[model samples]
Target: MRDYLIKATAFDGQIRAYAVQSTFLVEEARRRHDTWATASAALGRTMTIATMMGAMLKGDDKLTVKLEGGGPTGPIVADAGANGQVRGYITHPQVDFDLNDKGKLDVARAVGTTGSLSVVKDLGLKEHFTGQVPIVSGEVSEDFTYYFATSEQVPSAVGAGVLVNPDHTILAAGGFILQLMPGATEEIIELLEKSLEKIPPISSLIQQGKTPEDILNLLLGAENLKILETMPVEFSCSCSLDRIKDAIRGLGNEEIEQMIKEDNGADATCHFCNEHYHLTAAELDQLRQNGELQ
Candidate 1:
């Protein structure tokens, strides 16, 4: 099925939940970045979580998630908006390692257990809202769960997973986030904890062709979940050639002239999507004449 996420409430709105099947979305990112097995898992997990978080917003609101773990992969950055746009990159996309003791992708080894996970939200306010927390686990899900409980002060359960194929493609990718609202009873929390314990890993469920609704049922019980909305998700980049040209123009006339003199042209590549944009010498001259190259 097409990649999409579902927002829902359970137990009469005391429990807020989100679930998504992001196989195609994560596969697109892997193809764009040419990420290896471990890197694919790491990036896929982050993207899966970011897509769900993007659903939390309305209008043009957007957020950027940064995981700066001092590991082989270095830093992982992802941006998502209410419109379901997302783009991300890893400092090192070729990093790979042997599976962990659990026979799973060694994400912790690739992402490291040290550093922090930070989220910066552009809520259209004078000052954006930023929250951060130390990486409790190099696994992306736990780190996000920690961010919510410690930084956002919301009790949450977060689960994300990505399975990579032997050919270095994505096999499955998906996740879920469930939060307990105020007035949540102790009985409800206990029931949720039990339900979470019995549910399979999100990646495994996706590999089994389980849908987002299946994931929610696994977490909140089949009868308790009340579907609210479903939103399509994908790997989308907002970068364009014009945006790159504007950036080069902002480098000032001196820099533009130096480029025209030393190099016949200029080339720019977006880190998020790896899209290359080339600026011709004639175009540079025109920008200069128009005083666009301050």
Candidate 2:
């Protein structure tokens, strides 16, 4: 099935929940970055959580998630917007390691345990909102849980998982976020905690053909959840040749001339999607005339 996320409320809105199946979306990212198994899990989990967090925003509002774990996988950065657009990259996509003791990808080893998880949100205000917390666990989900509790001051449970095939492809990817709203009753919290402890890994559920709604039912109970909206999600990048050209122009005329004389042409590559753009000598000359090749 096509990837999508569900927003819902349970127990009369005292509990806010989100669940998403992001297999296709994460697969696209892995294909673009050529990430190894461990790196794929780390990056995929970050993307899954970021996409759900983006859903919390309104039009034109967006957020960037940075995971600087100081591990072999290096730093991971992801951007998500309310429009369901998300793009991300790992500083070291080729990193990999043997499965952990639990017979799962060693994400913590690849993601490292030292550093911080920071988020910057553009809420359409003069100043963006920023929050950060120490990385309590290199496992992406627990780190995000710590982030919400410490940074946002909201009690939350975050779970994300990605399973990779032997051929370095994505087998499954997805996650769930549960937040306790104001005045959440103790009984509801206890019920949720119990449910969380018993459910299978999110990735496994997605692999078994579970939809976002099905995930919510597994977590919050089918009868208790009130489905609100379903939004399509995917891997999307905003970078383009035009944007790259604009950036190149900002370098000034002398730099453009240097590229033309020394290199004959210019090549630019995007970090998010790894897309390469070539600027021919003729195009550079036109840009110089238009005062955009600087």
Candidate 3:
């Protein structure tokens, strides 16, 4: 099935939950970045969670999740928009290691525990909303859960998982986010916590052909869950050749002239999507002229 996300409310709106199946998008990322097994798991987990977080916003709001764990994979970054669009990348995509004792991809080793996870949100406001939390666990989900509890002052349960195939392609990737709304009763919280302990790993459930709705039913019970909305999710990068040209133009005339004199043309590649763009000598001249007008 195509990738998508569902937003739901449970326990009479006392709990907010989101679930997503991100297999296709994660696979796209693996192919684009040529990530190894462990690196694919790390990037996929981050992107999966970012997609759900994106659904938490409205309108043109967007957010960026930067995870700097000081591991061999370097930093992992995911950019997500309210419309269920997300794109992400890892600084070092070839990082991999033997599976951990649990026989799971060694994500914690690929993503060290020395750094922090920070989120910057552009809500179309005067100042962006920024929150940060120390990396409690190199595991992506725990770090995000801690971010929500410590930085945002919201009690949340975040679980994201990615299963990579032997050939380094993503086999399954999905996640769920559960948050306690204000005035959540003690009984409801207790029930939710108990349910969490019994649920299977999100990726495993997705691999078993479970839909987002089914996942929520397992979490909050079918009787208490109310589906609010569903939206298609994908790996979407907001980079374009025109945007690259504008950036080159912003570098000023001197830089453009130097490029024209020394290199004849310019080549640019997007970090998020790995799409390359070549600027011809004539294009460089035009950009320089455009810069002159500004």
Candidate 4:
């Protein structure tokens, strides 16, 4: 099935929930970065959660999630737009290790048990919103769960999983986020805690052909779920040749001339999608002239 996200409310709006199928996007990331199994799991899980978090915004709002665990996988950065578009990259993509005792990818080892997860949200305002919290677990999902509760002051359950194949491709990737609204009753909270314990790993469900809607229904009873919106999600990057040119222009005429003289051109690469942009000597000259005009 095509990658998508489902937004819903349960228990009469006391619970806000989101679920996403992110296999295609995760695979795209793995292909671009050539990440190994453990690194792929770390990157995939972060991107999966970022996609759902993006759905929480409106209009032209955007957010960036930075996870630095000081592990072999290094730092991970994910950018998401309100329109269900997300792109991410890992500082080190070639890190892998044997499966953990749970028979799962050793994400915690790859991500480390220290460091922090910071989120910066641009709400189209003068100042951006930022929140951060120490990593409680190197596992992406638990770290995010802690981030929401400690940084945002919202009680939440976050679950994201990526199953990597022996060939280093993504087998499955998916996730869910459930938050309790104000005035949530203790009875409902207890019920949710119990349900969370029994729910299967999100990636396993996706591999079994479960839709985002079906995942939510299984987490929060179908009878209590009220579907809000469905949005398509994908791996998208905002970098382009024009933007690269603009950045080079901002460096001023002296820098532009130096690039043309020393290197014969300028090369730019986007970390998010691994897209490369080359500016010919002629193009660099034009940008210098454009800078003079401005």
Candidate 5:
């Protein structure tokens, strides 16, 4: 099915939950970046969770997640907006390795045990909000879990998984986030923890064709969950030729002249989408005139 995300609350609103089925979106990303199995898993997981977080924002608000783990993959960057859009890329997308001890992708090894996961949120305010925490496991999910608990001071449980096909495409990709609200009793917390442990991996469930609703039913029980909102999610990038052209103009007339005089043309590629933008000599002249007007 098409990728989507669900927002819900359970146990009489003591617990807030979000889950998504992101196979299609992940496949698109894998195809775009040509990521290897392990790298695909890592990037897909981050993108999945970032999508969910984006849904938490108000209109025009957005956030960026940056993970620098000091591993072979270098860093991963993801951006999400209130409009249910997400895009991400890893600094190195061709890294792969054998399974971990748990027979899962070796994400921790590939992401490294050092470095940090940082987030910058633009809430339509004069100053953006920034939160950061050291990488707890280098597994994307646990690192986000730690970020919520430490950086945001919200007790949360996060699980993200991505299974890759032998051909390097995405087999499955998904995740869930559970947060405890104030006055949540210990009894409910224990029960939810047990339920999470009993369920299969998020990727396995999505691979089996489970919907986001089905995932919430398994974790929070069909009888208890109160569905709040459902939003379609996908791989979307806001970068475009116009935006790149504006950036080139922002470099001022002298830089544009230097490029036109020496390089003959300009090439710009977006980090998030890898979409290349080429500026011809004529385009550079136009940009130079615009810069002079500025």
Candidate 6:
């Protein structure tokens, strides 16, 4: 099935929640980046959480998430729009490591335990929202949990995971975020805490072919859960040849002339999607004469 996300509320609107199934999206990222096992797990986890965070926004608003753990994987950069579209890349996508003591992917080792997780939101009106927290754990999930409690000052329970096949492709990927809204009673919080303890790992559920609603039912139960909105999610990039061409033009006519004289053409690649765009010498000449990229 295609990837999708669901937004819901529980306990008479005292609790807000989101759940997502992101298998194909994460797999697409793994294929595009050629990420190894541990790298795949870390990147997938970040992308999963970032996608859910994107669902929290309104129209035309977007957010950027950065995981600079100072490990071999370098920094993980992801951007998501309110429409459930997300794209990201790890600076070093080839990093890998052996399983940890729990026999899980060694994401912490690959991601490092130092540095921080920072989020910047473009909310329009010449204003932006920023929140950052020191990395308490290199594991992506706990780091985000800390971010919620400290940076955003929201009492939230976050869980995200990605399972990689033997060949390093993503087998399953998913996550959930449960947030406490105003007037949440102590009883409601306690109930959610206990319920979370009894559920299986999110990745395990996704691997077993569970939907977002099934996962939400496991987290918040069906009786009190009210599904609000559901939207499709994917690994989508906003880069194109025309955009790259404009960037080349912005480098000024001298740069374009040099490219024509030395390399015969220019080949540019996007950091987010790794898509390549080439400009031939003839094209460069046209751009040089046109003044503005067409």
Which number leads on lDDT? 3
CA lDDT of every candidate: 0.91, 0.93, 0.94, 0.93, 0.92, 0.93
Worst 10 residues of 5 by lDDT: 285-294
The weakest ten consecutive residues by lDDT in model 2 span 285-294
Candidate 6 residue 118 Cα shift, in angstroms, is 0.5
Instruction: Please give, for residues 72-156, the per-residue lDDT of candidate 1 as tens digits.
Output: 9999999998876788898899989999999999998899998999999999999999998898889999999999999988999
Over 4 Å off, model 6: 291-294
Poorest lDDT segment (10 consecutive residues) of candidate 4: 285-294
Tens digit of lDDT per residue, candidate 3, span 89-110?
9999999999899989999999
Q: After TM-score superposition, what is the CA distance of residue 129 in candidate 5 from its true location, in Å?
A: 0.7
Candidate 3 residue spans exceeding 4 A from truth = 291-294
> For residues 1-294, could you state the per-residue lDDT of candidate 2 as single tens digits?
888998999999999999989999999999999999999999999999999999989999999999998899889999999878899999999989988999988999999999999999999999999999889979999999999988998899999999899999999999999999999999999999999999999999999999999999999889999999999999999998889788878888899888899988899889998899999887887776664443
How does residue 66 of candidate 4 score in lDDT?
A: 94
TM-score of each: 0.98, 0.98, 0.98, 0.97, 0.97, 0.98
Give the per-residue lDDT of model 5 (tens digit) for 1-294. 799999999999999999999898889888889899999998999999999989889899999999999999989999999888999999999999999898989999889889999999999999999999999899989999999999999999998889888899888989999999999999999999899889999999998999899998999899999999999999999999888888888899999999999999899988888888898888899888873322
RMSD of 2: 1.5
Tens digits of per-residue lDDT, candidate 4, 162-230, equal: 988889999899999999999999999999999999999999999999999999889888999999999
- The better-scoring model by lDDT among 1 and 3 is 3
